[model samples]
Target chain A: MTDAHEIRHEIRIATGDDIVRIRRAVRTVACAARMSLVDRTKLVTAASELARNVIGHGGGGTVRIERLISPSGVSGVRMVFEDAGPGIPDVRLALTDGWSTGQGLGLGLPGARRLVDEFDLQTVVGEGTRVTVTKWTR
Target chain B: MDRVPILKAGDVLLVSIQTDLEDRTVMALREDLAERIVRTGARGVVIDITAVEIVDSFIGQMLAGIAAMSQLLDARTVVVGMRPAVAITLVELGLSLGGVQTALDLETGLRLLGAGPLDGGPSEAQDRR
Candidate 1:
């Protein structure tokens, strides 16, 4: 009998050229946990978007990937994308489609949020932004 | 970023959206697709979003604009691989491109474009119009 706690793994990496590595790392973990194709796609896409945000929007940041075992006999993957970039002034407006910075398409944060089962975003005006996405498969 | 010419297959055109598909690219695609739609008289257009990580309001609006433009050319447009998170954020921010056609994958997008399927589809030469 394997302890549920023993199944968890954590990865932390810089948000530079390592963005792809972060994505691959998260994908490997999700695959090992037997996440469904659709679920896996969702997770990967979310990770890619978040990773890009840290690189493009924020100067750079840290990404943490972890596998969570819930109490309800359900398992899920949780990724936290934290950046110390100039924080979003309006979280609500930032999530709107078409409302992008004059730079890229502006779909990064909002799109990343929609790809996961549970999405949480917390940003401080002058500080930075933290986005968390979770995908669960029972 | 280097601009890649979109490919046309029979009556369908395949356009891949990567990066932050914004202004210049969106407009260029719109004009190019419109011209192709007019010249080939194709019935469908497939805009692949598999590589697109962001779809800001402008891009979303531009997508809708392109779809509208395609409609004028008598070709239907389908957007594929819209990440769920992006969809939710768009909805939350009220920047919804609700009227446009969307599919889960490229195969489905191709089907919507009137192609048989990505795999084993009839060998129809892809023409860039």
Candidate 2:
């Protein structure tokens, strides 16, 4: 298990522009890692969804991108979004498709999970929310 | 905010999404497109997204919004040239885009809207590239 990490980028999500920036940053790293085109697209889309959620739902946050070497020597990219806002009170409901408390399609959380190889979520009712997603070139 | 340009081609309004779009920009484009359709009395609208890398749920909503708005304005909306990867991602993202009509390329999209005096075919899309 190699399991090495290198921070590639740290993007602040303040406005609509930051969402675009995060998508570009993720694509850059995914391409450099020689990820396939479909994998790259899925990863980038997942990041875009999460980034928007950080602003629209989390009330604003930041995303960090990292390069990874999986256990079997596979290259991958990982991103973590962190926000200190009104955290989600219902994790299960929040991840359910077509369920939302805001003016959104209610697909952001679940959609993001479907687009990546690994997904992680942590949130506290009064604290914050943290989301981690990873996509490998395999 | 960078605005995506909307060009009037005969009775159709053509919009090519050539860059990464901010959520606000997509919203603005919706308004801009509505105004153009009404001002030009366009019978149809063509949105070319071959250059756009991804269409998240928000952008998907934007396309659906534009189509719905155009429908009420008595105009048809056709989205064209979506990348294969983007298409797969959208499906996995659970956005059926049921309300939006799509074509494989700009030429096909124009045909779907019933071309008026817009004689140019694939060249129009190629010229933009």
Q: Which candidate wins on TM-score?
A: 2
Model 2 per-residue lDDT tens digits across residues B1-129: 789899987899999998898888899999999999889999999999999989999999989999999999999999999999999999999999999999998887988887832555455556688
The sequence of per-residue lDDT tens digits that candidate 2 reaches over residues A20-130 is: 889989989898778999999999999999998999888899999988887778898999999998999889999999998888899999999999989999999778999
Per-residue lDDT of candidate 1, residues A1-138 (tens digit) = 344444443444453336556656776778766797656756765676677677677667877777777787677788888888898898899888657774656777776776778999899877898888888874
TM-score per prediction, in order, is 0.54, 0.93
DockQ of each model vs. true complex: 0.09, 0.85
True contacts kept of 2: 0.91
**Clash counts for all predictions:** 13, 0
RMSD of each: 7.7, 3.5
The CAPRI classification for model 2 reads as high
What is residue B31's positional error in candidate 1, in angstroms?
19
Give lDDT for model 2. Answer: 0.91
Candidate 2's clash total is 0
